[model samples]
Target: MALNTIIINTTTTTTTNNNNNKEDKELNSITHFFCAMKQQSPRRRRAALTTFFNTMPYTIDESQVLVMSSLWSMAMTNPTNPELPFSGALHCMSLLINKSLSQPSWLLLHQNIYIPYYAAHIIGSYTIKSSSLAELAVDAGAVPLLLELLRGRLSWVEQRVAARALGHLASYDSTFHAVALHGEEVINLAMKISTSCLKTVYTEFILSEDRKKYHCDLLTRGLGGKEMEDRKAEEWASQLQCWSLYLLSCFAFKDKGCHYLICRELGFLRELCRMWGGMVNGESPAGVGLMRILCRSSVGREAMAGCPEVVLSLCNLSRSSDDWQYMGIDCLVLLLKDLKTRIKVMNMALDCLVDLVELKNLGTRYNVGSTITKALLMDYHDHDKINSVVYRLWELKVERKRREGMMVEEELVKRWSLGEAKKKEGNERFYSGEIEEALLLYTQALELCPLKRRKERMIMYSNRAQCCLLLQDADKAVSDATRALCLSSPANSHCKSLWRRSQAYDMKGMAKESLMDCIMFVNLLVGENREKKKRKVIKVPYYAARMINKQMNAVGLFAGVVTGEGINMQTIEEEEEEGRRRRRWIKEG
Candidate 1:
C-alpha cells in the first residue's frame, strides 16, 4: 500500500511537472502572439501581462519548482541557454524592461516590474547573463553599471563575469574603442583576475585544474564518467575561458599596445583554443563568435598564425568521438575557411562527410550541425570538393555493381596481364574463364590505369562493373554504370565504359536504363566534340609571354600582380558573400 501511494505520488508529480511545462509553453506562445500583435508595443505587452497574471493564479507546483528553478538559474548565468527562464510574467517583464528603453513606456513610470517584485533575481541568484537581461542591460546603458560592479575582486566567478560583460560592451567599434581607452581601469581589473586562484568553481575537473596554461582537459578529467551533470559545467568553463581570453586579447591589443601583450595573449589564446579543441557547449555560441571576431580583427598577423593550431585542436575534438564530431565538423569547416586554415579544414571535412550522413542535435547540437551542412553544400560548388564527394559516391556505386556481376572486366584485365606466359600455356584456364579471378584482375587493372581517356572515377567503376557482369553479377554492373553516369557526362568519360554499362544493364533486364544511358552518353560526347572543334587553341609563342611591351618599358616587365608589400605575387581577391579570400598562388604560365 505504501509503494502504491509512493508510485501514485511520483505519477502525480510527473503530471504536475508536465502541466507546468505545458503552462510555461502555452504562456510563451500567447506571450509571443501578443508580442507580435503589439510588434513589441507597450499596451499589447501590458495586455499580455494582464493575461499572464490572470492565468498565474491557476498554476502552483512547488514540488519541482527547484528543478525548473535550476534551469532558470542556469539560463541566468549562461547567455546561450534557450529562453525558458524568461517565460511567463517574468520574461515578459524583462522584455518590457528593454521595450521601455526605446519608448518610455508607463512601466518605467511605475518602476517596480513583476520580475524584481517576485525577487527572481535574488530567489534564483540569476545574473544578467540571460540574453533578455543582457539585451535589456545593454539597451539601458548597463555598461557603466556593470563596470562598476566588477570593480573589486569578488568571488572569482563574479569578477570573470564582470570582465566578460565589459568585454561584450565593446562588441561594436565605438564601445570597443571606449572600453579600450579605459585602459588603466581594465588593466587593474585583469590584474586582479590574473592574480587570483586560477582554479575556481567550474564543473568538477576545472576545480582540479592548475588554473594555468596546462589545465586538465575538462572532458577527460573533470567529467570522468558523470557526463550528465559535468558536461554543462565543462561547456560553460570553455565558453568563459574563451570569453576571458578574447577580452584579454582585445584588451592587450587596445591598451598595453605592445608586442609582449599581444604575444602573451596570442600564446594564451592558442593554448585556450587547444584546451577547447573538441568540446561542445551548444548552449554557448560565444566561442564561435569570439573566434570569428578575432579572425576579422586587425590582429590577423598573429591570429592567422595561430589559426592552424586552433583547427588542429578542434579537429582533435572531432576525432575524439562521434557524439560531438558532427558539430565539431561544422565549426571545424568555418574555422578552416578562416584565412589560412583551409588544408586541415578540408581534409577533416571531406573525411567526415564521406563517412557520415549528417545527423541532428537534440540538446545542444542544432546550430553546429546546420553550420556544417551549409558548408558541405558550399564545398559541393568547388571543383575539388565535387571531385572528392562524387568520387567516393562512385566508389560505393562500383562495389554495388561488382556485387551484381561477379564476372570480369577491370579485374580480368589485371589477371590476364599478370602472366604473359600463362596466356600462352592454357587458353582453357584463361577462357574456361574462371569468371571470378578474371573479374578481380579486370577491376584491379581499372584501379591502376595511369591516364583515363575520359572521367577517371567513372572509367574505373565501369571497368570493375563489366568484370562483375562477366561473372554474372548483373546488379553490380548496373550500379557501376549508374554511378558513372552521375559522375560524368559522355563528354567527360571513355566511350567503351558507357556503352558497357548500357549493355550490362540490358543483360540485367534493365533495358530501359541501358537504352537511356546509351543515348545520353553519345549525345553529351557529340556536344563536347562540336565545341572543341569550333574553339581556337591559344597557341601564343613562348617568346611573346616574356616580351616587354614598349608602352610599359618604363614600368619594367610589368608581368607581376600588384601587392601592398611590394610583392609581385599572383594574389587574387575573391569576394564571397561571407568574407574576402585573398589567395596568393603561383601564376599559371
Candidate 2:
C-alpha cells in the first residue's frame, strides 16, 4: 500500500508540473503579442491590446506582471538570441520598420520612427559575422526593409545601419538568392542613394567655402554659402555613400550577383567608374572594390572594354601611390590573363597593361611586376586567335627577359674576352723574356677571370707560379702553386703545380714537404706508364732513388752541410731526353 501511494504522488506531481508549463507558455505568448502591438499607433495599440486581453483567460496580476517585465527586458537586452520568447515580436518590429521606411505616411511614422533604426542597427550588428543570424534576419524581411530604408529619407546613421544589414544579408547564398529576386529594384535604389550622397557631398563642398573679396563676385557668388555648417553633414554624407557602395559591392561579389547586375544594363561599368572618380582612397574602398570585382568577370570585362571611362579610371588608379595601386594592377592583370575573352575586352586589357607598364617605368624602371605566366598558358580554349594573342604576349615577356639577360651576358663576355687577350699577350711577353711585364699581365688575367671558369683560373695561377719561380720569388711561387692545386681536379692530376710547389719548398729548405710532392709525382708518372707502354721500369727507379738520396742527405749527418736546394732542372731534362731515346729503341727492338 505504501508503494502504491508513492507512485500515485509521483504521477500527481508530474501532471501538476505539465499544467504549470502550459500556463507559462500561454502567458509568454500573450506578453509577446502585446509588446508587438505596442509598436503600432495609439488607436491600433489600444484595439489590439484590448482584443488580446479580452480573449485571454488570465489577467496581469503582480507575478504575471513580473513575468511580462522579464520578457521585455530580455527582448531589449538580448534581442540577438534566437531562443528568446520575443522572436515573434522582433519579426513584427522588423516588418513594421520596413513599412514605415517605405510608406513614410504620418500614421506609420508616428507609430515608431526610432524603433526601426535601433532595430535595424542591432540586427545588422548581430548578423555581420553570423550567416545564420543573417539568414534569420532575411527571413524576417530584413532585405526589403533595409532596401526601403536605403530608398527613403533616412538619417546617415539609419542609412549606414540599413546598408550594412543589406550587405550582411547578401553574404549568405539563400539570402542573396532572395536579394537577386528583387535585383533591379535593389540595384537601382542603391545606385540612386550613392549618387545622391555623392551629389550632396559635392554641394556641401561648394557651399563650404566663403567668398574672398579679391575674387570676382560673379565667379564666387553661386559657389559660396556664408552661413552653412555643412562640413559635419558632408562627412556623414560621405560615410553613407561609402556604405552604399559597400552594399553594391556585396551584390557584385558573386557570379550570379554580377550577372544580375550587368545583365540589365551594359553601361553599368560607366556608372561605377564615374562614382570611382569621386572616391578618396583611404576614406572609401567599396567603389574601387566593386570595380575590381567587375573586372574579374568575363562579362564585366567586356562591359568595361566598351566603356572608355572605366579604362581611364583604372589607369588613373594604377598610377596612384596608395594601397589600391596593387589592386588596380591586379584587376588588369587578371583580365589580361584570359586571352579567350572577347577581342574588344582583350584589346582593352592590353591597353590597360601598356598604360600600367608605362606608368610603372616612369615611376621606377627596374622593379616591375608580372602576371602568373601559367594562367596565360592554361588551355582554356582551342581558338587560334585567342591562343595566338596569349602566345604573343608570352613571347613579348620572353623577349624582354631574353634581351635583358643577353645584355648582361654580353657585358660579361666582353670582360672575359679582355682577360683572355691579356693572357695571350702575357704569354708572348713571357716567351720574349719580359718577366716583369708578364707578371703584371698574368695578375690582370687572374683578376678578370670569372668565378665560373675554375679550370682556366687554375691554369692562370699555375702560369703565374712559373713566372714567380723564374723571378726567384719562392714565397710567391708557393702561394700561386698552392691556389692552383686547390682548384685542380684529381682525375687530371695537377702534376705541374705539384712539382712547382715541391721545387719552391726545397728552395725554402723544407725537405719533408718537397719529398711528399716528389713521391706523388713519381706515383702519378708510374701509373700513367703502366696504363700505356711498359717500358718505364728503369727510369722510375732512378728518379725515386735520386729523391730518396736528397731526402736522406738533407735530414741526416749532412743536414748542416746540405742546403735542400731546388731540383737540377737542366740535368733532369737531359735524363728525360735519354729516357725517351731508350724507350724508342726498346719499341723498335
Candidate 3:
C-alpha cells in the first residue's frame, strides 16, 4: 500500500511538470515571434507575422508586456520611414496589388498589407478585456499608428482592425485622450468610413471577381478557398463599419464640436437608419445605437427631426420586434421631449406613438409608452386635433374591451374550459395529418378563448399560424403570428410564434423582416438556456444557426444593386407609407 501511494504521487508530479513545460514553451514561442519581427530580413518578419496572426487569436495573455510593446512599435512605425520613431528596417517590397505577380513580389505585397493588420489586431485583442492593457497600449504610441490604418493606409481590412483597436483604447478614461488628440480627424474618418465602407468593400472585393487573385491568398491564408474569402470579406466589411461607428460613439456627446460635426452630416444620418448591421450581428445596435447617442444632444435631435426619412425609420423601428426596438423608442422619446423639436417631429411621430399606447415591456418605467404619448398630445399646439386623436384611440380601446367582455366569472371559466378542449382537439388533429380541420378548430378555440386569457389566445393564434404556413398562405400566417406576438407578455417573447412568422416572411421574400424574426427567436432561445442552466457560454441550436446564416446571405447589404436586382427606393417608401396609412387612427384629425 505504501508503494502504490508513492507511485500515484509520482505520476501526479510528472503530469504537473509536463503542463508547466508546455506553458513555458508557449511563452518562449511568443518571445521568439517578437524577436523575428525585429529581424532585418523581410522574409523572416513576414513568416513571423503570418504565424503570429494565425496563432494570436487562440492565445491571449495580459502578462506579456514585452510582446505588447513590440507589437505597438511594429504597428505604429512605418518601416519605410527612417525618421519615424521605432521604425524598422526598410525592405524593397512593392505595395501595389498585382494579379500577375511573381512569387517573390506576391510575398512582398503580402507582408506590406498583413503586418499592420495583424499588429493592430493583436493590440486590439490584448486591450479588449483589460483597461490596464489598454493604458499600456496607449503609452506605447499605439494611437497614432492605429490612426494611420483608420485613414485607409492599406485597405478597409486594416481600417477594421485599426478602428476596433482605437475604440478599445478610447473606452478607458486613462487612454481616451490619447485617441482624443486626433479627435476631429478620427471622428471624420470614422464617419466617412462608416457611411462608405460597405459600398467600397462590395465594389472592390465582391463585385470585381477578377481582383480576387490579388487578396485571395491573404484572405484565405492558403488554407481556405473562395467561399472562405467571401465570408471573411463580408465579416470584415461589417466590422469596419461597426468598429468605425463604435469609435465615433466613444467620442459622441463628449465634445460639442464633434457632436455638431456628426449631426451636420445629413447623409450620414440617413445612412445610419438604413445600416441595420444585418441580423447575423444581433449584438450590435449598429446605426440605432449611434442614433441613440446623437439623440441625447440638442443638435442631434434637431437634425433627426429635420430628416423626414429618419423620423419615419424610427417610427417603424419603434413598432417592430427588432433587438434594438427600445433604443428606437428612446430616440423618438428624446425627439418628443425636446420642446424645440417636438413640433417638427409631432406629425410623423403621432401615428406611431398612438399605436404604442399599450406597449408594456419597452422601457424601464411602467406604461412608459402611454406616458410619452400623453406628453406629446398635451404639449402640442393643436389641442383640437390632439384631443380628437386621443378620443378616437380611447374609443377603439373601450370598444375592444366591451366586445370581449359581458361574461361573468362562471361564464368565463366555462368558456376557458371549452377553449382548452378545442385546443387539445386541434392539436390532435394537427398531429394526425388533418391540417384544414386543425386550422378550423384553432380558429374556433380562439373565438371561444377569453381575450383576458392572453396566454391561451396567444397559443391558439400561434397554432393557426402554423396551419397557415402549411397551407401556403403567407399573409394569414404573418397576421396570426403577429397577433400572437402582440398578446404575449413582455411582447415578442413567444418563440414558436416568432419562428412561424419568420418562415412566413421568408416565403414572402421579405429577407430583412425574416432575418429580424429569426434573430429574435435565436436570442430568446439563448437567453432561456443561459437563465435555466446558469452557464456562461450559450450555444445556439444548429438548425437556428443555419437559418440565420442563410438569411444573412440573402439580406446582404448592397447586394441587390450589385446583382442587378436593386429595389426601387421610391416604391419602398410608398409601401412603407401605405403600411403607416393602414395603422393610422387619427388621420387628418
By TM-score, the best candidate is 3
| Structural similarity to truth (TM-score) of each candidate | 0.32, 0.44, 0.63
Score candidate 2 by TM-score against the native: 0.44
For model 3, how does the per-residue alpha-carbon lDDT over 101-174 read when each residue is reduced to its tens digit?
22333324423334445566666766676676676667666777678778876677777878998998888888
> Residue 69's C-alpha lDDT in candidate 2?
38
Predicted structure 1, TM vs. truth? 0.32
- Backbone clash pairs for candidate 3 read none
Against the reference, the lDDT scores of all candidates come to: 0.42, 0.57, 0.71
Q: Which stretches of candidate 2 lie over 4 Å from their true place?
A: 1-113, 153-157, 200-229, 255-267, 277-284, 337-368, 372-397, 403-589
lDDT string, candidate 1, 217-276, tens digits: 322433454354345444444444545545655564454442233332333334334222
Q: Quote the lDDT for 108 in model 1.
A: 31
Best by lDDT: 3
